[model samples]
Target: MLRRLAAALLSVLLVVLAPVAAQAFVWARSSDALTLDPHVANEGPTVALIQNIYEGLTERDRAGRLGPLLAVSWRMLPEEPTVWEFKLRGGVTFQDGSRFSADDVVFSYRRAKQPNSGFSDYFASVVAIEKVDDLTVRIRTRGPNPAFVENTPAIFIMSKAWSERNGAAQIPDNATTDANFANAHANGTGAFVLVSRQPHVRTELRRNEAYWNRGHVALGIANLTYRPIPRASARVAELLSGAVDFLQDVPIQDLPRLRAQSGLTVTSGVENRTIFLGFDVASQAPRGTEAGGRNPFADLRVRRAMNIAIDRDQIQRVVMRGEALPSGIIIPPLVNGWTGELDTPPPFAPARARQLLAEAGYPEGFATTLYCPNDRYVYGEETCRALVLMLGRVGIRVKLVAQPQAEQSSALRRTPGPDLFLAGWGSPTYDSEQVFSSLYHSRDGQRGAYNATGYSDLQADEMIGKLSSEIDGGRRDALIARLWQKLRGDLIYLPLYHQMLSYAMKEAYDIPVDVSNMPKLKLVAAPTR
Candidate 1:
C-alpha cells in the first residue's frame, strides 16, 4: 500500500509539471504595421510585421548576418558577371500548402518592381529574372552588380499562384484608401501564420506547423500576439500588469524605473537608423510658408542656415537623453560608406546661420510648419518641439504639426509634401546604395520611392545609377565619397543623430535587439517552467 501511494504521488507531480503544449506570448509596441502586403511599404514596422508571415530569398540571423532562407545557394556567374543564380529550397511549401518554386521568385521580382511597389529601388539594376529550372532562377542585371546579395534579404518572395488567384498581383498602394486580399490575409512559408489582423488595435498569429525551418529554428512560442499601444504610459502599465510578456519599444524616461523592477529584463543597442529633417526642395512655392513667390528651402543659403542653426550635441544630451549617437551623415556608421570625416557635424553657430539667412534674401526670416510623426520614432514630438525653439533662435519662426506615422507618411508622399518634415531612415541593406538610391535619387518609377523631400539632382542621380553596377571596390568607394561630398555641401537635410533602441520583457523570455530595430520573435528563447 505504501509503494502504491508513493507511485501515485510521483505520477501526479509529473502531470502537474508537464510543460504546456500551447501558450500565447503577448508583445507590444508603439506603432502598428501600415499594411500586410509585403511589397506595399518598405517602412520598418510594416516590414517587420510582414516578415513574420512572409520570407525572402535570404534573411539576417539573430546576429544580423545574412543567410539562406527560401534560397539554398546563390552566386554571380563567372562569365556573365551581371547574371546572379539562386537555387531555391525544395520540399518547402507555403502556408496554404502550395509548393514554392522558381516561378514564384520570378513573379515576386516582377511584382516588386511594379509602379505601386515601394521596393522598386532595390531592383533598379535588374534587367530581367529568368527561371532556369523548377528550382533555379537567374537574375540578369544591367551591369556587373556587386551588392546584389545584400539587397535580396529585403526582396521577399510570394506565391505566384496564390497572388494571381487572389488578385494580389499588383501591390496595394498604402498611401491611398484601398483594399485587397493580401491587405488582410497572408499565405507565406514563414514560421508564423496570420490568424487575425485588426489594424492599430491587435494582430494575432500562430506558429506554422508546416514551417520548413521548424526543426532548424526555435519556434518556442506556440502563439504570438502583438498590440500597438501608442501611449508610453499605457504600454508600461500593460507590461507591469502582466498583460504583456514583451515590449519592443521601451520609452527612454521609463528605462531606469523598468530596469530596477523585478521579473523584467531590459536590453538596449544602437539601431542602424538616422533621424533627420527634410524640406520640399523641388517645390517652387511650397505650402505653409511665409516666403513670397519663391521656395525658401530651394536656396542653398537658407538650407545651410537651417542645418547649422540647430545644435546636435545639445539635442543628443537633452532631447535624446544620451540614447543617440550624433551623426553628420544620413547613413549610420554600420553602413559601408560611412567615414569619420563624413560623420562630423558642422559647428553650432546661430550667428552664422542668421547671417546665411540674411544673405539668402530673408533678413527677417520666414515662418513655416514642421510636420513630425508623434509615435514613429523615440521622442519624435519632443525633438521637433526642441527644433522649433532652436530654429527660433535664428530668424525662422516655425510652427509644429505632429500626427501619427500613417498620416505623416501620407502627407510626405503626397504631391508637394510638407514644407519641412522630420523623417528617419534605416538602411536595410547595410550599404550606401540603399540610402543614396532611395533618399537622394530623383523621383522616378524605379527609384526615389522614399524621397519625399522632393530634392532632385541629375548629377547625383547618374552617380547613384553607376554605384549599382560598379564591380571594383576601390572605384565604388570613390564614387560614393564624391556623391556624399556633393550632398553634404548641398545640405538637403539637417543631419540628426543615429537612434538607439531598448526592449523590456519578462525575465522568462530572451529576445535580442536587432540592428534593424526589428526583432524576430521566431529566434526568441522562452523558459520552459
Candidate 2:
C-alpha cells in the first residue's frame, strides 16, 4: 500500500514538472483563403478559417446539439413565440481584452440585416434586438421560428465600437464598395485573430492569448494558413508528402493513396451540402442559345427529357466511386428539412432523352455550354466532364467552361447568363426555410441573386411566407411539406448529389472535435505528449 501511494505521488509530481506542449496548431482546408470575415465570407473555401477566428453566442457539438458560447442561458416569453430573453455569461472577454456585453450582440445583429448583405439569415426570423442590460438581451422575431433560438447565438458577433472606429458602419457584403471592419480585422471573442489576408492566396490567423474561454481545450496559441490549389494533382501531392498537413477536398481517385499513408488519417462525413442543376424559366432563350436555347428547356417535354436522360447510378459508381449518392431535393437527408421520397435512376439513357427531345420539337439534338467551377465543389470539373460525355452520346453537345474559385463566385453573382451550371447549397442554420427562401423567395428572385435560374412559383412563395410568420408547430410543418411537395413536383432544380466533408489529420494533432463548424484551439486544454 505504501509503495502504491508513493507511485501515485510521483506520477502527480511528474505531471506538474513536465513541460506542456506549446498551445499552437495549424488547420488546413482545400481552397485558398479568400477572406477571414465570416459575414462576408460565404463560400465553403472560406468558412473553415471563419470557424477558427469567430465565436457565435452558441455552438453545435458532435451530436448537433446547441450549447453555450457567449450566452450561458436564455428563455422564451410565455406570451409569444416571437419574443426571447437571454442572459449573457458575465466573465467572457473579447480578444482585445474588452468584457463581453449585450451591446456587442446588438451591434453584430443590426449589421447582419443591412441591405444586400448575403447573411440575412441572421435576421431570417429576427425582428428587433433590444439590449436590456449589460448582460441581458431580448430578441423579437417576425414569428415563432423553431430554429430561431438555435441559430441566433451562432451568427458570429462583431464589436459595436470597433465597427464605427474602422468605418465598417454596415454589415459585410462582398458587394460593399469598401471592406467592412470584419473584412480587415476580427473583433469577435473567438480563439484566433485575423493577422493578414491576400485574396485567393493566403490568410493567416494567430492564437488569441486573452481568449474568454479558460480551463478548456479552446485556450491555445496557434497559427493557421490556407491556400487554394485548384489542381487535384497538386492538392494530393501536398497531402501525400506532408508539404501541407491537411486538404479539404480529398479527391475520390486519391482517397486510396491518402488512406495508405501511415502518418495521416482521412476524415469525411455527409457534409450539409446538396449539389443541384437549375433552369431559367423567367427569360427567353437567345436564338443562338446552346441546347437549342430557351424554348427547348421551357417546354415541359424538354425539361422532363433532360431529367429522364440523367444516369445518376453511373455517376455514383464511376465518377464518385461510390463516395456520393444521387439526390432529388436541395437539402441533404442529414438535415431536418430534407425531402424523404423520390425515384431517380442513372447510367444515363441518351436514347430516352432523344425521344423526349424529339417530342419537344428538337428532333435533332442541340448543343450548349455548361458553366461550372473547377474548385468549388469536390471534383466539380471532373463531374462536368463526365456529364458532358454522357450528354454527347445522346446528340447533345456540351461545351465546358471551368474557371477557378474566384471567377466561379463572380459568375454565380451574374445569376442568369450561364446556360446550365453546377452549384451547391448548404443551410448554415440547418433548416429548410433557409434553403427555400434564399433560393426561391420572389423578393430575392426579383433581384436575381439567390434565384439564379429565375424559378417562380407564387404558391411556393406563399408557403414560405406563411412558414415565416407561423408560431405554431403543426401548421408550420404542414406548410413546409406543402413547399416540399411543390418543389419536388415542379422539378426546376435537379439535385445531383449531397456532399460529405473530408478531413485529413495526424492523430497527435488533437483538439476538441465537433461538427458544429466552430473551431477554437485553446492552450488551456492543449494535450500533453
Candidate 3:
C-alpha cells in the first residue's frame, strides 16, 4: 500500500511538468541528417542541421547576404591579392568553454582539406593557412580567387582541442557504415548544443546560454527537437494536431488544406536548386544497362533523344502541382551568369525521340535503372515514376529504384554506382563557376566530387580553370556564357525544374523562407500569447 501511494504521487507530479516541456520547439522533416560532422557531407539537409550546432567565419543571413559569424572583419592583401586575412572575434567560446582563436581556424582548414573529407573541393585553390597571432589569420591561395570568400560559409570550424582529445582528428568516411566519435556527437560555438541523438528516430538540442551572438540575434527557442517523419501524411497530421511547431517541405497536394487551417501559416519561396538526370557518357559499356557491348549514352543523338522524351511542363503542372518552375539549365536563374537564351528546354516529342533512338542503333531501345531517393526531395519518387512512364512511351524501359537518401547516397559514391541516376545541384556560392567546376568539369583529385557520370571536356576544363583567377566582370561573364553554350550543345544533363519550397508553422511564430533552404532557428520569432 505504501509503494503504490508513492508511485501515484510521482506520476501526478510528472504530469504537471509535461506541458512546460512541450514549449520546446519541434521541427519536423522527412529525413534525418547524415552526420553531425560538418566536414563530412556537402548535402543541403545535412548542412542545414549542422549549421545550428556549428558555425563558420562568415555566414549568409536570411536575405542571402554576407554577414559575420566568427570573424569580425576580413580583407585581401594589397601587395598579394592571392592572400586574404581575417580578424577573429575575441572573447568567443565554444560550447565546451574553449577559447576561440586563429589556431582553431588553421586546424579546421587543414582538416577540411583531408582526403576523406568531401569538402576538399571548396579548398582546392587554398595553398596554405597561417596564424599571425591569436586573433589574426591569413590564407594564401594558388591564384587570385574572387570566389574564395563566398565559399567560406560552407566550411564550418571545429574546436581543435575537443576534436584531438576525443580522437576525432579526421572526418569519418561516409561511404561505409563506420562509427567514429564525431559521427553522433557535436562540439561547436553555435546557438544550439546537442543533448541527444537517435538516428532515424529523433534528435534533441537545447539553447546554448553562453552563445556569443545571443545579444546580436533573436533566439526565441529555448529547446529544439527534430523528428523525421518519412510519411508525408503523418508529417502533416503532426502539424495539424499541435504535436509539432514547424514543418519543413510541406507537400504540394496538402497546401490548400493547410492554408485553410486556422492556426497554421504557410510560406512559399523558390529555391536556388536544380533537379536533373545524369548519364555515364564516358564509359565504353555503362553498368546495369541492356546494351551489352556499347554505351548508348556515348552517342550525342541518344542523349538528345533522352532529353526530348521528358515533358518538363507537365512535370511542373501535375507532379509538382503547379509549384515548380520548368528549367532547361542545371543552374537556376538566381545564380550569376544565367541567361534566358540558354534556359530554353527541348520540346517533348515522343515520335522524334523514338526515331532518334532507332537511328542510333537502338531500334528496340534498352533497359536501364534510375536510382532515386524517396524522402530526400519533395515528390522525388513521384517524379521518377512519371519519368519512367514517359520514357517507356519512347521505347526506353527504365526500372525505378527508390530508397532513403542515406542509402541512395552511398550507392552514388560506389564504383560505377549507376548508369542513370536522378540528382540535384545547388550552388552554395551563388555563382556559376561552382556548378561548372563541380558538375561539368572532369572528375579529378581536386574537383568533380559529384560528377558520377564521367562527363569531361578539355575545353570546358580550361575555361573552368581560368575562372578561378579571373577578376574582370565582363570577361568572367563572357566565359560563363561560352561554357553554357558548349554544355548545351553537348547535352550533358537532362534539366528538369527548379523546386519550390513550402514551409508551414503555427500562427504564433514567424519564420522566413531562405532561398538556400537553410532555415536558421535564430531568426524564428514567437509572440507572447
Candidate 4:
C-alpha cells in the first residue's frame, strides 16, 4: 500500500521552476537543526547553514585544496605538517570587538578539546599551542596527523572572553538541555547572524554588516532566512509558488516540473559530498540472535554483496533524477592528491549480490533496521526506501526506521544503531584523509561526532596515520590511493553517490557557489538594481 502511494507521489512531482543558471536564491531544509555551534555540528544541513556563521582556520579553495582561512601565512617547521607556525592576518576582530590574537586561538583550541565540542580530534595531534604574539601562533604536534591542515576546516576561532562570559565554553549533550546563550547564538566575524529558530519550522539569519571580510570576491548577500520544510514536496511547492528562492535536495522525480517552469534555473554538477552506508564493527561480531552474534559485515564477501546489490546508476537516474554521480570511495575527484584511477565504485548486479550472500551463508536473507533521517538531505528518506526495496530484490529484508535529524544523529552517536543506516559526508576541509580517517579510524571511530559507522580497520587506520605524516605531495598521493584500495577491498563502507549541488533561483537574484560550496549569506549576489 505504501509503495503504491510513494510511486504515485513520485509520478506527479516532475515540475520544477529552477533556472538553467542559478543566482541568489532561497534554500529549504528537510529536517530540524541539531546545533548552531561550529564545533559540534555533525549533519550536512547543520553545516549548510552554520558554515556562514563561523570562520575556520582553513577552508576549501575553488580548487578544493586546503587554503588559509584565518591563517594568513603558514610554514612547516618540520617535514610533516606536524610542526607549523601560522601568521594570523592582522587587523582581524571577533564580532564582539575583541581583537583576534594568539590568545583567542589557544582558547578556541582548548574549548574544542572539551568532549562536548566534538572538534578536538581535528586538533588531537597538537602537542602545544604557543602564542607568538597578537597576530601569530605556533602549533606543534607530536606525531604527524597528515590531515591536520585539512582538518582545520572546523577550527573556528572564537573570542575567549565572549565564550567564557556566555557559558558556552562547554556544550551539553543536547543544545536545548542546560541551555546556554551560545546554543542559539553566534559571535563570529562571518557574514551571517541568527535571527530566530523554531525547531521544526525555520531558522532565520541576517547578514552581518560588520563582516570582517565584506565583499571581497563574495557575492553581496545581506539578508537570508532558511526554513526547515520536512516534506520534499512542500519544499518544491514553495519553490515553484515563489515562496522560496532556493531548495536543494530537489526530488529527482520532480525535475521535469522544475525544468518546465519558466521563472527558474537549476545548476548542478559533481559535488564533493558522498552518501554511504556504514557497519558497526564496535563489536567483534554482529550483535543479534539472527547470526548468534556473528558480524556478517566482518566478511568482505558480505560487504561486496551489499555493494553489488546497490544499483547506483538506477538510483542516480530514477532516484537522484540525474543530480548526482555514483561514487566508490570516500574522497571525490575534486580534492587534492586525488588519483585518477582507484576504488572505482563497481556496478550493481543483484545476481552477484545474491551469490555472495549465499556464499556468506545468508541465502534466505537477514533482517535489520536501516536508520535514516526523515529530513536531512533531499530524498534522503526516499533513498533509503529505495535501497530497502533494492536489497529486498536480493533477498535482504531491511526494515526502514526514519526519524528527525536530531534524534537520528543522537541515536547513531549513542548506540551502534539498528545494524545499518544511510548518512552523508562533505569535505569542507577538502582533505581525503580527514574524510576517511575521521570516520574509519579505530581510535577515533567511537561516534565522537564524526564516525557514524563505528567501523574501523587497523590497516586503514595505520595508512591514514602514515598519509597524515607524509610531507611530499607525490608520496602522499601514492599512500592515499593504496589506502583507498585497501578500504574498498575490506568493504568497510558502501558509498552511494557524489552530490551535485543545485540551486534554483529567480533570474534577478544571485548566489555564488562553485568548488567551495559553503552557502554564505554574505555571498548572495543580488540584483544590481
Taking the candidates one at a time, how many backbone clashes does each contain?
Answer: 0, 18, 0, 24
Worst 10 residues of 2 by lDDT: 511-520
Model 4: residues >4 Å from true position, as ranges?
A: 1-26, 61-68, 78-81, 144-147, 173-179, 215-219, 282-289, 337-340, 444-449
**What's the TM for model 2?**
0.88
- lDDT per residue for candidate 2 within 1-529, as digits (tens), equals 9999999999999998764544334444446645555566456656656766777777766546678878888777888768888888888877777778899888877776664555664466577999999998998987776567656544777777876788776754454345655665777777777778776667777777676665465453456666666677877777666666546667888787777878777766666777777756556873335654454556676666676676777777888887777877888775665655742433355687889888877788787767787777777787788878876776767788887766666555554636677788876667777777777765451222466666777778778767766777777777777788777777777778876556665544543333433334442244455
Arrange candidates by TM-score, descending.
1, 3, 2, 4
Question: lDDT for each of the candidates?
Answer: 0.89, 0.67, 0.86, 0.70
Q: Please, what's the RMSD in Å of model 4?
A: 10.4
Clashing pairs in 1: none
Better of 1 and 3 by lDDT: 1
Candidate 1: 10-residue stretch with minimal lDDT? 15-24
Candidate number with the higher TM-score (1 or 3): 1
How accurate locally is residue 374 in candidate 3, as Cα lDDT from 0 to 100? 89
Estimate, for each residue in 143-243, the C-alpha lDDT of model 4 and write its tens digit: 65545666666677777888889887776666546657666787776677777777667777766667667747453555566777878788888988888
Q: What is the C-alpha lDDT profile of model 3 across 1-529, one tens digit per residue? A: 9999999999988776543322479999998888888887888778999999999999987667888889998888889999999999999999999999998999998998875676777877788999999999999988888778888899898999999999888776653477578888899999999999998899999888899989877777888999989999999999999999999979889999999999999988888889998888887887778875888988999999999999999999999999888888998888987878778878999899999999999989988888888888889889999999999988889999888988877765554557888888889889998888777777676677667778888989988888888877789889888888898889888999988888999998878788899999976754454
Clashes of 2: 18
Off by over 4 Å in 1: 1-22, 173-175
Candidate 2 RMSD computed on C-alpha atoms after optimal superposition onto the true structure: 3.9
